[model samples]
Target: MYCKHCRQVMDNDFCPDCRKATRMPEADDICFLAERGHPWSDILCDVLKQEGIPFLRQSNLGHGLMSMIGQGLELESIYVNWKDWERAVDVAAGLFSEDVEILWDEEDELQE
Candidate 1:
Protein backbone atom coordinates (compact mmCIF):
# COMPACT_ATOMS: atom_id res chain seq x y z
CA MET A 1 0.00 0.00 0.00
CA TYR A 2 1.01 3.62 -0.44
CA CYS A 3 0.72 6.34 2.20
CA LYS A 4 -1.86 8.86 1.06
CA HIS A 5 -0.09 11.76 2.77
CA CYS A 6 3.48 11.12 1.72
CA ARG A 7 2.81 9.02 -1.36
CA GLN A 8 5.35 6.49 -0.12
CA VAL A 9 4.99 2.72 -0.15
CA MET A 10 3.80 1.40 3.20
CA ASP A 11 3.28 -2.01 4.67
CA ASN A 12 0.62 -0.94 7.19
CA ASP A 13 -1.80 1.86 8.09
CA PHE A 14 1.04 3.84 9.68
CA CYS A 15 3.64 5.62 7.60
CA PRO A 16 6.97 4.83 9.22
CA ASP A 17 8.88 7.49 7.32
CA CYS A 18 6.35 10.16 8.11
CA ARG A 19 5.85 8.86 11.64
CA LYS A 20 2.09 9.38 11.36
CA ALA A 21 -1.07 7.53 10.49
CA THR A 22 -1.64 7.23 6.76
CA ARG A 23 -5.40 7.30 7.00
CA MET A 24 -7.95 9.03 9.21
CA PRO A 25 -7.82 7.76 12.72
CA GLU A 26 -10.61 5.44 13.65
CA ALA A 27 -11.69 4.36 17.14
CA ASP A 28 -9.14 1.57 16.90
CA ASP A 29 -6.37 3.54 15.26
CA ILE A 30 -2.88 3.30 16.71
CA CYS A 31 -1.69 6.06 19.04
CA PHE A 32 1.66 6.91 20.56
CA LEU A 33 2.00 5.55 24.09
CA ALA A 34 5.54 6.40 25.07
CA GLU A 35 9.13 6.84 24.01
CA ARG A 36 11.99 5.20 25.88
CA GLY A 37 15.51 4.04 25.36
CA HIS A 38 16.82 0.49 25.19
CA PRO A 39 16.07 -1.65 28.23
CA TRP A 40 13.12 0.46 29.34
CA SER A 41 11.40 0.09 25.99
CA ASP A 42 12.07 -3.63 25.99
CA ILE A 43 10.74 -3.96 29.50
CA LEU A 44 7.63 -1.93 28.67
CA CYS A 45 6.90 -4.09 25.63
CA ASP A 46 7.14 -7.22 27.75
CA VAL A 47 4.86 -5.77 30.40
CA LEU A 48 2.30 -4.68 27.81
CA LYS A 49 2.24 -8.22 26.43
CA GLN A 50 1.79 -9.74 29.91
CA GLU A 51 -1.27 -7.53 30.34
CA GLY A 52 -2.68 -8.66 26.95
CA ILE A 53 -2.34 -5.25 25.34
CA PRO A 54 -1.30 -5.10 21.68
CA PHE A 55 1.59 -2.75 20.96
CA LEU A 56 3.98 -1.75 18.20
CA ARG A 57 7.55 -0.59 18.77
CA GLN A 58 9.08 1.71 16.23
CA SER A 59 12.80 2.41 16.35
CA ASN A 60 14.00 5.91 15.62
CA LEU A 61 17.06 4.44 13.94
CA GLY A 62 15.06 2.39 11.43
CA HIS A 63 15.06 -1.41 11.11
CA GLY A 64 18.42 -1.78 9.42
CA LEU A 65 20.21 0.49 11.89
CA MET A 66 18.37 -1.04 14.85
CA SER A 67 19.50 -4.48 13.70
CA MET A 68 23.05 -3.20 13.58
CA ILE A 69 23.04 -1.30 16.90
CA GLY A 70 20.39 -3.27 18.74
CA GLN A 71 18.56 -0.07 19.80
CA GLY A 72 21.23 0.72 22.37
CA LEU A 73 21.85 4.34 21.36
CA GLU A 74 18.38 5.33 20.25
CA LEU A 75 14.84 5.65 21.54
CA GLU A 76 11.91 3.42 20.68
CA SER A 77 8.42 4.81 20.22
CA ILE A 78 5.66 2.56 21.56
CA TYR A 79 2.17 2.63 20.09
CA VAL A 80 -1.12 1.02 21.03
CA ASN A 81 -4.60 1.18 19.56
CA TRP A 82 -6.76 4.11 20.74
CA LYS A 83 -9.17 1.69 22.33
CA ASP A 84 -6.34 0.30 24.44
CA TRP A 85 -4.72 3.60 25.41
CA GLU A 86 -6.23 3.83 28.87
CA ARG A 87 -5.47 0.25 29.78
CA ALA A 88 -2.00 0.54 28.31
CA VAL A 89 -1.35 3.67 30.38
CA ASP A 90 -2.46 1.89 33.52
CA VAL A 91 -0.17 -0.98 32.73
CA ALA A 92 2.68 1.40 32.20
CA ALA A 93 2.03 3.22 35.45
CA GLY A 94 1.91 0.01 37.40
CA LEU A 95 5.19 -1.09 35.86
CA PHE A 96 6.96 2.09 36.90
CA SER A 97 7.24 3.78 40.25
CA GLU A 98 5.65 7.14 41.19
CA ASP A 99 8.90 9.04 40.65
CA VAL A 100 9.04 7.76 37.12
CA GLU A 101 6.31 9.89 35.60
CA ILE A 102 4.73 8.59 32.42
CA LEU A 103 2.98 11.46 30.75
CA TRP A 104 0.45 10.37 28.12
CA ASP A 105 -0.78 13.83 27.21
CA GLU A 106 0.20 17.39 27.97
CA GLU A 107 -3.33 18.52 28.86
CA ASP A 108 -4.23 15.27 30.61
CA GLU A 109 -3.23 16.34 34.17
CA LEU A 110 -3.15 12.61 34.90
CA GLN A 111 0.44 11.53 35.41
CA GLU A 112 1.92 8.28 36.53
Candidate 2:
Protein backbone atom coordinates (compact mmCIF):
# COMPACT_ATOMS: atom_id res chain seq x y z
CA MET A 1 0.00 0.00 0.00
CA TYR A 2 0.93 3.64 -0.39
CA CYS A 3 0.80 6.22 2.30
CA LYS A 4 -2.04 8.68 1.75
CA HIS A 5 -0.08 11.41 3.47
CA CYS A 6 3.22 11.31 1.59
CA ARG A 7 2.20 9.16 -1.41
CA GLN A 8 5.08 6.82 -0.75
CA VAL A 9 4.92 3.07 -1.14
CA MET A 10 4.48 1.40 2.21
CA ASP A 11 5.65 -2.07 3.12
CA ASN A 12 3.58 -2.30 6.26
CA ASP A 13 0.99 -0.48 8.34
CA PHE A 14 3.54 2.20 9.25
CA CYS A 15 4.72 4.48 6.51
CA PRO A 16 8.48 4.76 6.21
CA ASP A 17 8.07 7.94 4.19
CA CYS A 18 6.16 9.92 6.81
CA ARG A 19 6.86 7.54 9.68
CA LYS A 20 3.17 7.42 10.61
CA ALA A 21 0.64 4.64 10.67
CA THR A 22 -0.76 3.54 7.32
CA ARG A 23 -3.27 0.87 8.23
CA MET A 24 -6.25 3.13 8.64
CA PRO A 25 -9.72 1.58 8.27
CA GLU A 26 -11.29 2.00 4.86
CA ALA A 27 -14.65 3.07 6.27
CA ASP A 28 -13.18 6.05 8.15
CA ASP A 29 -11.76 7.80 5.14
CA ILE A 30 -13.29 11.20 5.64
CA CYS A 31 -11.06 13.31 3.46
CA PHE A 32 -11.33 17.03 3.93
CA LEU A 33 -13.23 16.71 7.14
CA ALA A 34 -12.92 20.35 8.18
CA GLU A 35 -11.96 23.72 6.77
CA ARG A 36 -9.03 25.93 7.68
CA GLY A 37 -10.88 28.40 9.86
CA HIS A 38 -12.59 25.80 12.00
CA PRO A 39 -11.00 25.23 15.37
CA TRP A 40 -12.21 21.67 15.25
CA SER A 41 -9.65 20.83 12.60
CA ASP A 42 -6.72 21.32 14.90
CA ILE A 43 -8.56 19.75 17.79
CA LEU A 44 -9.49 16.72 15.70
CA CYS A 45 -5.95 16.35 14.45
CA ASP A 46 -4.70 16.30 17.98
CA VAL A 47 -7.36 13.84 18.99
CA LEU A 48 -6.52 11.61 16.06
CA LYS A 49 -2.90 11.68 17.04
CA GLN A 50 -3.81 10.78 20.58
CA GLU A 51 -6.00 7.98 19.31
CA GLY A 52 -3.28 6.71 16.94
CA ILE A 53 -5.07 7.45 13.67
CA PRO A 54 -3.06 8.25 10.57
CA PHE A 55 -4.13 11.56 9.08
CA LEU A 56 -2.92 14.51 7.07
CA ARG A 57 -3.59 18.25 7.15
CA GLN A 58 -3.65 19.88 3.77
CA SER A 59 -4.18 23.49 2.72
CA ASN A 60 -4.19 25.19 -0.64
CA LEU A 61 -1.39 27.70 -1.04
CA GLY A 62 -3.66 29.66 -3.32
CA HIS A 63 -6.26 29.66 -0.60
CA GLY A 64 -3.79 31.16 1.83
CA LEU A 65 -2.80 33.79 -0.68
CA MET A 66 -6.42 34.45 -1.47
CA SER A 67 -7.16 34.93 2.17
CA MET A 68 -4.42 37.53 2.30
CA ILE A 69 -5.67 39.09 -0.95
CA GLY A 70 -9.18 39.43 0.52
CA GLN A 71 -10.70 36.83 -1.76
CA GLY A 72 -11.20 34.49 1.24
CA LEU A 73 -10.58 31.03 -0.14
CA GLU A 74 -11.83 27.86 1.49
CA LEU A 75 -10.27 26.59 4.71
CA GLU A 76 -7.63 23.88 4.83
CA SER A 77 -8.79 20.35 5.53
CA ILE A 78 -7.92 17.06 7.19
CA TYR A 79 -7.60 13.85 5.20
CA VAL A 80 -7.03 10.15 5.75
CA ASN A 81 -6.70 7.05 3.65
CA TRP A 82 -9.93 5.50 2.31
CA LYS A 83 -9.38 2.60 4.66
CA ASP A 84 -9.16 4.75 7.74
CA TRP A 85 -11.95 7.22 6.96
CA GLU A 86 -14.72 5.85 9.13
CA ARG A 87 -12.57 4.95 12.12
CA ALA A 88 -10.95 8.31 11.95
CA VAL A 89 -14.35 9.95 11.84
CA ASP A 90 -15.49 7.86 14.76
CA VAL A 91 -12.39 8.75 16.71
CA ALA A 92 -12.94 12.41 15.97
CA ALA A 93 -16.61 12.13 16.86
CA GLY A 94 -15.77 10.32 20.07
CA LEU A 95 -13.22 12.94 20.94
CA PHE A 96 -15.14 16.03 19.91
CA SER A 97 -18.61 14.60 20.39
CA GLU A 98 -21.24 17.30 19.80
CA ASP A 99 -18.66 19.73 18.46
CA VAL A 100 -18.15 17.69 15.28
CA GLU A 101 -19.60 19.97 12.64
CA ILE A 102 -19.03 19.91 8.91
CA LEU A 103 -16.35 22.57 8.85
CA TRP A 104 -15.67 22.14 5.17
CA ASP A 105 -18.88 23.24 3.48
CA GLU A 106 -17.40 22.49 0.06
CA GLU A 107 -17.33 18.72 0.56
CA ASP A 108 -14.46 16.43 -0.54
CA GLU A 109 -12.33 18.58 -2.81
CA LEU A 110 -8.95 17.69 -1.41
CA GLN A 111 -6.21 16.45 -3.72
CA GLU A 112 -4.34 13.24 -2.99
Candidate 3:
Protein backbone atom coordinates (compact mmCIF):
# COMPACT_ATOMS: atom_id res chain seq x y z
CA MET A 1 0.00 0.00 0.00
CA TYR A 2 1.00 3.62 -0.44
CA CYS A 3 1.60 5.88 2.52
CA LYS A 4 -1.15 8.42 2.99
CA HIS A 5 1.14 10.93 4.67
CA CYS A 6 3.86 10.65 2.07
CA ARG A 7 2.93 9.10 -1.26
CA GLN A 8 5.82 6.70 -1.37
CA VAL A 9 5.84 3.18 -2.84
CA MET A 10 5.90 0.86 0.13
CA ASP A 11 7.73 -2.45 0.29
CA ASN A 12 6.57 -3.53 3.73
CA ASP A 13 3.65 -2.59 5.92
CA PHE A 14 5.42 0.64 6.84
CA CYS A 15 6.58 3.17 4.31
CA PRO A 16 10.33 3.29 4.07
CA ASP A 17 10.44 6.91 2.95
CA CYS A 18 7.91 8.32 5.40
CA ARG A 19 8.29 5.74 8.15
CA LYS A 20 4.56 5.49 8.60
CA ALA A 21 2.60 2.26 8.50
CA THR A 22 0.70 1.93 5.23
CA ARG A 23 -1.22 -1.16 6.16
CA MET A 24 -3.58 -2.05 8.96
CA PRO A 25 -1.64 -1.12 12.10
CA GLU A 26 -1.20 -3.45 15.04
CA ALA A 27 -1.00 -2.51 18.70
CA ASP A 28 2.69 -1.78 18.23
CA ASP A 29 1.93 0.51 15.27
CA ILE A 30 -0.09 2.94 17.27
CA CYS A 31 1.28 6.53 16.94
CA PHE A 32 1.53 9.00 19.76
CA LEU A 33 -0.57 12.13 19.29
CA ALA A 34 -0.36 14.20 22.46
CA GLU A 35 -0.16 14.27 26.25
CA ARG A 36 -2.36 16.27 28.56
CA GLY A 37 -3.90 16.26 32.02
CA HIS A 38 -7.46 15.63 33.14
CA PRO A 39 -10.27 17.43 31.34
CA TRP A 40 -8.10 18.30 28.37
CA SER A 41 -7.46 14.65 27.62
CA ASP A 42 -11.13 13.95 28.08
CA ILE A 43 -12.06 16.74 25.68
CA LEU A 44 -9.66 15.55 23.00
CA CYS A 45 -10.86 11.97 23.42
CA ASP A 46 -14.43 13.09 22.95
CA VAL A 47 -13.52 14.97 19.78
CA LEU A 48 -11.69 11.96 18.41
CA LYS A 49 -14.72 9.81 19.14
CA GLN A 50 -17.00 12.24 17.39
CA GLU A 51 -14.71 12.30 14.36
CA GLY A 52 -14.72 8.48 14.33
CA ILE A 53 -10.99 8.33 14.87
CA PRO A 54 -9.95 5.35 16.95
CA PHE A 55 -7.59 6.24 19.78
CA LEU A 56 -6.05 4.98 22.99
CA ARG A 57 -5.89 7.09 26.15
CA GLN A 58 -3.27 5.87 28.57
CA SER A 59 -2.02 7.28 31.82
CA ASN A 60 1.66 8.19 31.95
CA LEU A 61 1.86 7.30 35.60
CA GLY A 62 2.19 3.73 36.82
CA HIS A 63 -1.05 1.89 37.35
CA GLY A 64 -0.59 1.76 41.11
CA LEU A 65 0.16 5.47 41.31
CA MET A 66 -2.70 6.28 38.98
CA SER A 67 -5.05 4.26 41.11
CA MET A 68 -3.79 5.76 44.34
CA ILE A 69 -3.58 9.35 43.19
CA GLY A 70 -6.58 9.17 40.84
CA GLN A 71 -6.69 9.31 37.06
CA GLY A 72 -7.53 13.01 36.98
CA LEU A 73 -4.25 13.96 38.65
CA GLU A 74 -1.98 11.97 36.35
CA LEU A 75 -1.07 12.91 32.80
CA GLU A 76 -2.81 11.03 30.00
CA SER A 77 -1.37 10.26 26.61
CA ILE A 78 -3.29 9.98 23.36
CA TYR A 79 -2.40 7.48 20.68
CA VAL A 80 -3.99 6.56 17.39
CA ASN A 81 -3.60 3.93 14.70
CA TRP A 82 -1.31 4.93 11.84
CA LYS A 83 -4.20 5.00 9.38
CA ASP A 84 -6.15 7.52 11.43
CA TRP A 85 -3.15 9.55 12.54
CA GLU A 86 -3.56 12.42 10.10
CA ARG A 87 -7.19 12.94 10.89
CA ALA A 88 -6.60 12.69 14.62
CA VAL A 89 -3.82 15.24 14.36
CA ASP A 90 -6.03 17.60 12.42
CA VAL A 91 -8.67 17.34 15.10
CA ALA A 92 -6.17 18.00 17.84
CA ALA A 93 -4.69 20.94 15.97
CA GLY A 94 -8.08 22.45 15.39
CA LEU A 95 -8.97 22.13 19.04
CA PHE A 96 -5.76 22.85 20.91
CA SER A 97 -2.75 24.30 19.16
CA GLU A 98 -0.53 25.46 22.01
CA ASP A 99 -1.46 23.24 24.91
CA VAL A 100 -1.23 19.96 23.00
CA GLU A 101 2.13 18.40 23.68
CA ILE A 102 3.16 16.30 20.70
CA LEU A 103 6.53 14.62 20.71
CA TRP A 104 7.22 15.25 17.05
CA ASP A 105 10.85 14.15 17.14
CA GLU A 106 9.99 10.86 18.78
CA GLU A 107 7.84 9.74 15.84
CA ASP A 108 10.98 8.32 14.24
CA GLU A 109 11.04 5.64 16.93
CA LEU A 110 7.85 4.19 15.45
CA GLN A 111 9.77 3.15 12.35
CA GLU A 112 11.91 0.87 14.43
Candidate 4:
Protein backbone atom coordinates (compact mmCIF):
# COMPACT_ATOMS: atom_id res chain seq x y z
CA MET A 1 0.00 0.00 0.00
CA TYR A 2 1.01 3.62 -0.48
CA CYS A 3 1.30 6.17 2.25
CA LYS A 4 -1.16 8.81 1.13
CA HIS A 5 0.36 11.45 3.41
CA CYS A 6 4.00 11.16 2.36
CA ARG A 7 3.47 9.08 -0.79
CA GLN A 8 5.82 6.35 0.45
CA VAL A 9 5.47 2.85 -0.91
CA MET A 10 5.08 0.69 2.20
CA ASP A 11 5.02 -3.09 2.41
CA ASN A 12 2.77 -3.14 5.45
CA ASP A 13 -0.34 -1.09 6.07
CA PHE A 14 1.62 1.39 8.18
CA CYS A 15 3.91 3.97 6.67
CA PRO A 16 7.28 3.54 8.43
CA ASP A 17 8.61 6.74 6.86
CA CYS A 18 5.80 8.91 8.18
CA ARG A 19 5.46 6.87 11.39
CA LYS A 20 1.72 7.02 11.11
CA ALA A 21 -0.97 4.43 10.72
CA THR A 22 -2.39 4.15 7.24
CA ARG A 23 -5.87 3.01 6.57
CA MET A 24 -8.47 3.22 3.83
CA PRO A 25 -11.47 5.29 4.60
CA GLU A 26 -14.54 3.27 5.40
CA ALA A 27 -17.64 3.73 3.29
CA ASP A 28 -18.90 6.30 5.77
CA ASP A 29 -15.58 8.08 6.24
CA ILE A 30 -14.84 11.20 4.23
CA CYS A 31 -11.19 11.53 5.25
CA PHE A 32 -9.27 10.79 2.07
CA LEU A 33 -6.48 13.28 2.58
CA ALA A 34 -4.23 13.44 5.62
CA GLU A 35 -4.03 16.26 8.13
CA ARG A 36 -2.44 19.14 6.28
CA GLY A 37 -1.87 22.71 7.34
CA HIS A 38 -3.29 25.79 5.73
CA PRO A 39 -2.10 27.55 2.56
CA TRP A 40 -0.55 24.41 1.07
CA SER A 41 -3.62 22.47 2.11
CA ASP A 42 -5.80 25.01 0.38
CA ILE A 43 -3.84 24.60 -2.82
CA LEU A 44 -4.09 20.82 -2.58
CA CYS A 45 -7.83 21.03 -2.09
CA ASP A 46 -8.18 23.21 -5.17
CA VAL A 47 -6.14 20.79 -7.21
CA LEU A 48 -8.19 17.85 -5.98
CA LYS A 49 -11.35 19.63 -7.03
CA GLN A 50 -9.87 20.50 -10.38
CA GLU A 51 -9.01 16.85 -10.88
CA GLY A 52 -12.63 15.89 -10.16
CA ILE A 53 -11.74 13.65 -7.22
CA PRO A 54 -14.50 13.87 -4.65
CA PHE A 55 -13.25 14.65 -1.13
CA LEU A 56 -14.03 16.45 2.09
CA ARG A 57 -12.18 18.65 4.53
CA GLN A 58 -12.53 17.89 8.20
CA SER A 59 -11.58 19.89 11.30
CA ASN A 60 -11.58 19.16 14.99
CA LEU A 61 -12.67 21.31 17.92
CA GLY A 62 -9.03 21.48 19.04
CA HIS A 63 -8.42 23.73 16.06
CA GLY A 64 -10.27 26.46 17.85
CA LEU A 65 -8.12 25.97 20.92
CA MET A 66 -4.98 25.85 18.86
CA SER A 67 -5.92 29.17 17.30
CA MET A 68 -6.70 30.63 20.67
CA ILE A 69 -3.41 29.47 22.16
CA GLY A 70 -1.48 30.28 19.01
CA GLN A 71 -0.22 26.70 18.71
CA GLY A 72 -0.91 26.80 14.95
CA LEU A 73 -1.33 23.06 14.60
CA GLU A 74 -2.98 22.08 11.35
CA LEU A 75 -6.04 19.96 11.98
CA GLU A 76 -7.60 20.46 8.59
CA SER A 77 -7.74 17.30 6.44
CA ILE A 78 -9.04 16.18 3.06
CA TYR A 79 -10.97 12.96 2.78
CA VAL A 80 -12.39 10.75 0.04
CA ASN A 81 -13.77 7.29 -0.25
CA TRP A 82 -11.09 4.60 0.27
CA LYS A 83 -11.89 3.35 -3.22
CA ASP A 84 -10.36 6.51 -4.69
CA TRP A 85 -7.17 6.41 -2.60
CA GLU A 86 -4.99 5.44 -5.54
CA ARG A 87 -6.17 8.05 -8.01
CA ALA A 88 -6.31 10.66 -5.29
CA VAL A 89 -2.76 9.89 -4.26
CA ASP A 90 -1.63 10.05 -7.88
CA VAL A 91 -3.25 13.42 -8.43
CA ALA A 92 -1.62 14.81 -5.30
CA ALA A 93 1.79 13.34 -6.08
CA GLY A 94 1.83 14.87 -9.57
CA LEU A 95 1.58 18.34 -8.09
CA PHE A 96 4.98 18.25 -6.40
CA SER A 97 8.39 16.64 -6.53
CA GLU A 98 8.51 13.42 -4.50
CA ASP A 99 12.25 13.88 -4.01
CA VAL A 100 11.80 16.91 -1.77
CA GLU A 101 8.59 16.29 0.07
CA ILE A 102 8.85 16.79 3.86
CA LEU A 103 6.87 14.76 6.31
CA TRP A 104 5.91 16.41 9.60
CA ASP A 105 5.29 14.21 12.59
CA GLU A 106 3.23 15.77 15.37
CA GLU A 107 3.54 12.73 17.57
CA ASP A 108 7.31 12.71 17.67
CA GLU A 109 8.80 13.56 21.03
CA LEU A 110 11.30 16.40 21.19
CA GLN A 111 14.86 15.19 21.53
CA GLU A 112 16.05 18.49 22.89
Higher-TM-score candidate of 1 and 3: 1
User: Candidate 3, TM-score vs. the true structure?
Assistant: 0.57
- With a 3 Å backbone cut-off (N, CA, C), the pairs that clash in candidate 1 are none
Q: In candidate 2, where is summed lDDT lowest over 10 consecutive residues? A: 103-112
lDDT of 2 at 91: 76
After TM-score superposition, the amount by which residue 15's alpha carbon in candidate 3 deviates from its true location, in angstroms, is 15
State each model's CA lDDT, in order: 0.73, 0.61, 0.74, 0.63
TM-score of 2: 0.45
Off by over 4 Å in 3: 1-28, 70-72, 98-112
lDDT of 1 at 6: 51
Predicted candidate 3 versus true structure: per-residue lDDT over 34-79, tens digit per residue:
8899878988897797688888988889988888988778898898
Backbone clash count, each prediction separately: 0, 13, 0, 4
> Best-fitting candidate, measured by lDDT?
3
Top TM-score prediction, candidate number: 1
Query: What's the best-to-worst order under lDDT?
Result: 3, 1, 4, 2
Q: Judged by lDDT against the true structure, how good is candidate 3?
A: 0.74
TM per prediction: 0.58, 0.45, 0.57, 0.51
